[model samples]
Target: MIADPEGTVLALFAAFCRIGACIMVLPGFSSFRVPVQIRLFIAVAVSMALLPVMWDSIYPRVQGGGSNYLLLVGVEMLIGVTMGLIARYIVLAMQFAGTGISMAIGFNAAPGGGLLEAEPEGHITAFISFTVLFVLFLSDFHHMVIAALVRSYSFMPVGADFDPRMALMTLTDTLAGAFMLALRLASPFLVYGLIFNLSIGMVNKLSPQIPVYFISIPFILFGGLILLYFGSQSFFTLFVNGFEPLYLGLP
Candidate 1:
C-alpha cells in the first residue's frame, strides 16, 4: 500500500504548505501567545489527516514536479492566506468595535497588552476581545474553519487561476461588512456618550464654578459600565451568529 513513500511525503508537504500558511494568520491559532512549534505541529497534523481525502487531487500534481509544482505551491499559499484573512478581518472588526466602545464609554486608560497582537489596547477593550475569542473557541470555530477549507478544494482546486480583481472585491466587501458590524455594536455607547457629554457641557456653561465636568466623570463611568454589563451577552451573540454566514457561506 505504501509503495511510493517519497511521493506520498512530497504530497503531504504540499498540503502542509497551504495549511501551515493558513494557521500562520488564523485568528486564535495565530495569536502571539501560541508558540510557533505548536502551530507548526498542528498544521502538519492537519495536513496528514487531510492527505487521504485530498490525495487524488494533490498527488498527481506532485508527481509532475517543476515550475508547475512550484506554482501550485505558491497558489496554495495565496489561497490559504486569503481564507485566513477573511476570518481575520472579522475578528479585527470586533477589536475595532471594542476600541470605539471604550472611547464612547469614557473608559480610556493606559493601554494594556493585546489579546492577539503586540498592539496595546484599552483595559476594557482587551477584556471584551479575549472574552469573545473564548466564546468563539467554545463554539468550535476551528472545526467550522477546517470544514470550509476542505470544501474550498472543490471550488478553488490546487493551482487554480488566481483572480486579483475578485480577491480585491471580496476584501472590500469584508471591510464594508466589518465596518457596519462594528458601528452597529458600538452605536448605543456612542449615543449615550453624546447625550451625557452634551448635558454636562450645558451644565458647565450654566454653573462654571461648580466643577461640573470633573463631577461628571464618575457618573459617566458608572452608567457606561452598567450598560456594558447589560449589553455584552447580546453583543457577543450577534457577532458569533453573523461570522459563519459572512465567511463560511461565501459563494
Candidate 2:
C-alpha cells in the first residue's frame, strides 16, 4: 500500500495518544518501576499495530477542524483511562483485603512499598495482593484487557458524545465489587480475630488483674500470620477467579 505521509503520521499520533493514556493507568504498565521511555515505546508500537484496523473508524471521526480533532483525542483518552482504572481496581481490592486483614490481626502498622504502593498495609494482606496480581498476569488475564480495548471502540466510537452515565456506573460497580472481594479475602482473619477476641474477653472477665491487651496482641498477630501462610494461596485463587467476571463485564 502506498504510504500517505500526512494520513499515516496523524493516524500514528492518534493511536499513540489513545495508547499512552491507557498505559499511564493500566496495571503492570502503570507500575512505578517501568521507565517512561519503555512505556512510551510500547504504547506507540501497540497503537501502530492496531492502527490499520482502527484508522478507518477513528480517522473519519477525528478529522475536520483542529478543535474536533482535539475533542476526539480527548474522548479516546477518556475511554482508555476508564478501562485502565477499572482493571486496576481489582488490585486495589486485594490491597484493601490486606489492609482489613491487618487491622483484624493486629498488624495495623503501615505497609511497605513494592506491589501496590509504599503505604501501610497488613503484612499478609500485602503479600496476598501482590501474589494475586502476579498470578493474574501469569494466567494471561491481560489478554482480556486488550480484548476490552478493541471492543471499546464499538461502544464508544471516536467523535461520538461521551456518556458520563456509563462511566459513573462502571466506577460504582467496580468499587462495590472491590470492597466485597476485599472482605471475602479477609474473612479468615476476621473470623480468627472474632474468636480470639471473644476468648480473651472471657479470660479478662475471669481474671480482672491480668493485662490481656499486651498478651492478646501478640497471640492474635501470631495466629494471623499462621492463618495467612496457610490460606493465602486459596484466597488469591479466589481473587483471580473473581477478577475474570468483573473484567469481562467492562464496556
Candidate 3:
C-alpha cells in the first residue's frame, strides 16, 4: 500500500475527475432520468477500476502540489466532458433525425415524457428513439465507451496540457459528421414529404373545393408508417454501425 493515504486519495480523485465527468454525460448513464447518486457511484467504481493502471502516471503528478495540480484536475475534467460531448452529439443527431421523421410523416404531437427529457414528440418518434437506444445497449456499446476511455490516457496523457484547439477541432468534426448522418437518416422522409406535398398541391389546383390536405393526411400518415415499419431494422442497424467509428474517430 502507498505510505501516504492522503496523497493516494487525492490521486484517486484526479482519476475520478475524468471518469466521473465522462459518465455524467455519456449516453445511457447521462440521462437526467438516472438518479445522481447512481451515476456518482458508477463513476467512483469506474475510477477504482482504472486507478491501478493509471496510478503510475497520475500519482507522481499529485505529489507535486500547487496551483498546477488544480489546473491538471480542471483540464482532466474538461477533457472528460469533451469526450462525453463527442458521444452526446451522436445521440443528438439521432434525435434530430427522429424529429425530422416525425414531422415528415405529420406525426407531431404535444411534448411528453422521454428517457432524456420531456419534449415534443410523436409516438413513433419516441418509439424509434427508445428502440435505437435500447439496441445500442444490447450491442454492448457501453463497453466500447469504456474501452475508448481507457485508450484516452495515451492520447491525452495524465498531467499533460490538453490543447483547447484540438478539443475545438474534435468537437467541430463530430458535429459535422453527426449533422451529415442526421441528414442521411432523414433524407428518405424528406423526399417523401416533398413528393407527397407537391402532389397534393397539384390535386388541389385541379379541384379547388376538395379539402386535399385534410384527406391527404391519412394517406401520408399511412404511407409513412408503412415505410417506417419496413425500414426500422435497417435504420437502427445503420445507426449502431456508424456510432463506434464516429466515436473512435482519428485520435
Candidate 4:
C-alpha cells in the first residue's frame, strides 16, 4: 500500500536526526544515570509520534536523496544540538547558583556525590539542584520541550541553510539570561552572608580576646538555615516561573 517505502524511511530518519540529537543532550533525559538504550528508545518513539505531523515538511526535502540529503541531516543535527544545549546551559546556570548559595550560607561542608551527576557537590548545592530539577519535571518541562520541537520546524525548516552566527548569538543570549536568573536567585543569600560577616567582624574587633570568628560560625549557619527555610518557597517559585521565559525566548 505504501507508494514509496524508501522515501518514507528517509523521512523518518530525517525526523529522528533532529529529535534524537536533541534528546541526546536534553537535561533530565540526557542525565548520566539514564541508560543509553532508554534514551534511544525515547528519541525513536518521539520521532515516530511526530513524524506524521511533520511528514509534509520532511518527506519533500528527503525525496531527492543525494549528497544534499547528507548535508540536511548534518544541519538538522546541529540545530537540534543547539536547541538542546540552550536548555542544558540553563540547568548548568542553576547549578552554578546553587554553588554560590552554598558558599554564601556557610554550608561548605565536604563535597559528596551529586544527586543528579557523577561529580561531588556540597549538600546545599546538591539539594537546590535536585529540587529545582524535580520542580521542573513536576511542571511538565518535557511537555514544553515537545511543544518547542513541534514549533521548531517553523523557525528552522527542513533543508534550510544552517546559520552558525544566529545559533551562536542565541546561545550567547541563553547564557546571559540564565546567569542573570542565577544571580537573582542567589542574591538574597549573598547579601545575608555579607551583612552577617561584617557584623561578626565588628564584634571581633570590639572584643579582640574572644574567638569571635569561630564562635560566629554556628550563628551564621543557623541564621542561614532559617533564611533558607523561609525563602525556599519563593526561590523555587521564581525559578519555575523564569524557566518558561528563558526557554520560549530561544530560537
Candidate 5:
C-alpha cells in the first residue's frame, strides 16, 4: 500500500511546477502548433517519471506542507521559467540574425506566416529559423535540456529562495552571448552586402546617365543567394557548435 499519499501528491505537483513551466516556454515544445493539452500531458508524464528519481530530494521538502510549501512552488516555477527563457533567448537571437541577413541581402520580400510561430516572417527569416530549429532537434538538444533539468535540483534545490538579481544577470549574459554568436553567423553576409553596395555606388557615380540602382538590384540579390547557398553548411555548423557553450555556461 502507499504511505503518506498526500505527501507523495504534493511532491509530484512540486516536481511538475518546475518541469511543466520549463516545457511551457521551451522552444519546440512551446510552439503555437502544439496543443495545450499535449503540453500538459507531456509535463505531467515527465513529472511522474522523474518523481521516483527525485523522491529523496523533493518528498522531504514538501512533507511539512505549509505556507513554506507555497514559496517553494513559486520558486520552482521561477527557476523553470528562467531556464526555459535561456534557451528561448538563444533561438530568438538566431531569428534576429536571420532578419539582418534578409535586410543586408536585399531580400525584403513580403513576409508570410512563420512555420513555428504565428507571427509573419520574411521568407529568409522563416527559412533560417526553421532550419536552425530543425538542426537543434536533430542534434537532440531536448536531451540536453532534460539532463540540465535533472541536474538543476543539485544546485537550485527545493525550498531555496529565488534570487531575482542572479536570474537577471544570467539572462543578461545569455543575451550578450547570443548576440555575439548571431553576429558571427551574419558577419560574412553583412560584409558582402557592404562591399556590393559600395561597388554599385561607384559604378553609378561613373555613369550617372544609367539607372544603376534598379539595374544593380538583380546582381546583388543573385550574389547574396549564391553566398547563402555556399555558406549555409558552415553557418549551421557554427550555430550548433555555439549553442552548447552558451547554454551550459548559464549559472
Candidate 6:
C-alpha cells in the first residue's frame, strides 16, 4: 500500500492543480492585472484549507496509483473548467450589454482592446466590460466562485466520467442566455438612440440648412451619460442576481 501521508499530499496537490487551473480562467479571480504569484499563492492556500475537510472523501479513491488516478485527474479538470466557464459566461453577459450599448450610441466606431485575445471591440464597450469585471471582484462575488469550486467535488466526485454532450449543451445554453441578458440591459439605450436619431433626422429634412449632426452630438452624449448614471445600480443588481443562478448550475 502507498504511504498514507504521501498519498494525502498527492491528493491535495492534485486538487490544488485543478482548482488553480479553474481560477486562472474564472471571472473575478482571473484578472490580467493581478500578479501570477499572488494568484498561485491564493490557490495553494485555498487547497490547503480544503484538503483536510475533504480528505476523508477524496483520499480513498486517489490513494492507489493506477488508471483511476488519471481518470480522477481528468474528471477534476473537467469539473473545474465547467465551473469556470459558467462564471465566465456571466461576465460575458456584461460585455454583450456593453457592446450593444456602444453600437447604439455610435461609440462602436472607436477601436479598443479585445475581451480575451485578438477579439476586437469598441473603446466604450471595453471600458464597460472591464468595469463590470472589476466590480465583480470588488463586490466579493469571488467568494461565491470559491464556494462553487468546493461544492463541485460533492456534485461531481473524482473518477466519474462527465457527459461531454451535456457539457456542450450547458455551455451553449449559458452563452445564449448571457447574450439575451445583455440585450435586455442595453435595450433602454438602444431605444433612446433610435428615437433621438429619428427625431433629428426628421428635423434635418425639415430644414436642410441646419447642421443637425453637430447640434445633436452633445445632446446624445449628455443623454447617454445621464442614462448610464441612472441605470448603473439596476445593472449591477441584475448582474449579481443572474450570476448566482449560473454559478449554482455548474457541475
Model 2 residue 123 CA deviation (Å) reads 3.0
- Order the numbered candidates by TM-score, best leading: 5, 4, 1, 3, 2, 6
All predictions: root-mean-square deviation over Cα?
Answer: 1.5, 2.1, 1.6, 1.4, 1.2, 3.0
TM-score of candidate 5 on Cα atoms, chains taken together? 0.97
**Best-matching candidate per TM-score:** 5
Residue pairs in candidate 3 whose N, alpha carbon or C atoms collide under 3 angstroms: none
Structural RMSD, model 6:
3.0
Assess candidate 6 and give its lDDT. 0.77
lDDT of 2 by residue, 120-227 (tens): 555666677668778988988767877777777787776787788999899789988878877887888999999999999999999989999999999999988899
Which 10 consecutive residues of model 3 have the lowest summed lDDT?
Answer: 115-124
Tens-digit lDDT track for model 4 on 156-198?
A: 9999999999999889999999999999999999999999999
Candidate 5: Cα lDDT at 123: 94
Task: Please provide TM-scores, in order, for all candidate models, with all chains considered together.
Answer: 0.95, 0.91, 0.94, 0.97, 0.97, 0.87
lDDT of 4: 0.91
lDDT at position 62, candidate 5? 97
Q: What is each predicted model's overall lDDT from 0 to 1? A: 0.85, 0.79, 0.85, 0.91, 0.93, 0.77
Q: Give the TM-score of candidate 3.
A: 0.94
Model 4 pairs whose backbones collide: none
Which ten contiguous residues of candidate 5 have the minimum total lDDT? 242-251
Question: Which scores higher on lDDT, 2 or 6?
Answer: 2
Residue 13 in model 5: shift from native, Å? 0.6
In model 6, the runs with Cα more than 4 Å from the true position are 1-3, 112-123
Model 5 alpha-carbon miss at residue 77, Å: 0.7
Alpha-carbon shift of residue 220 in model 3 (angstroms): 0.3
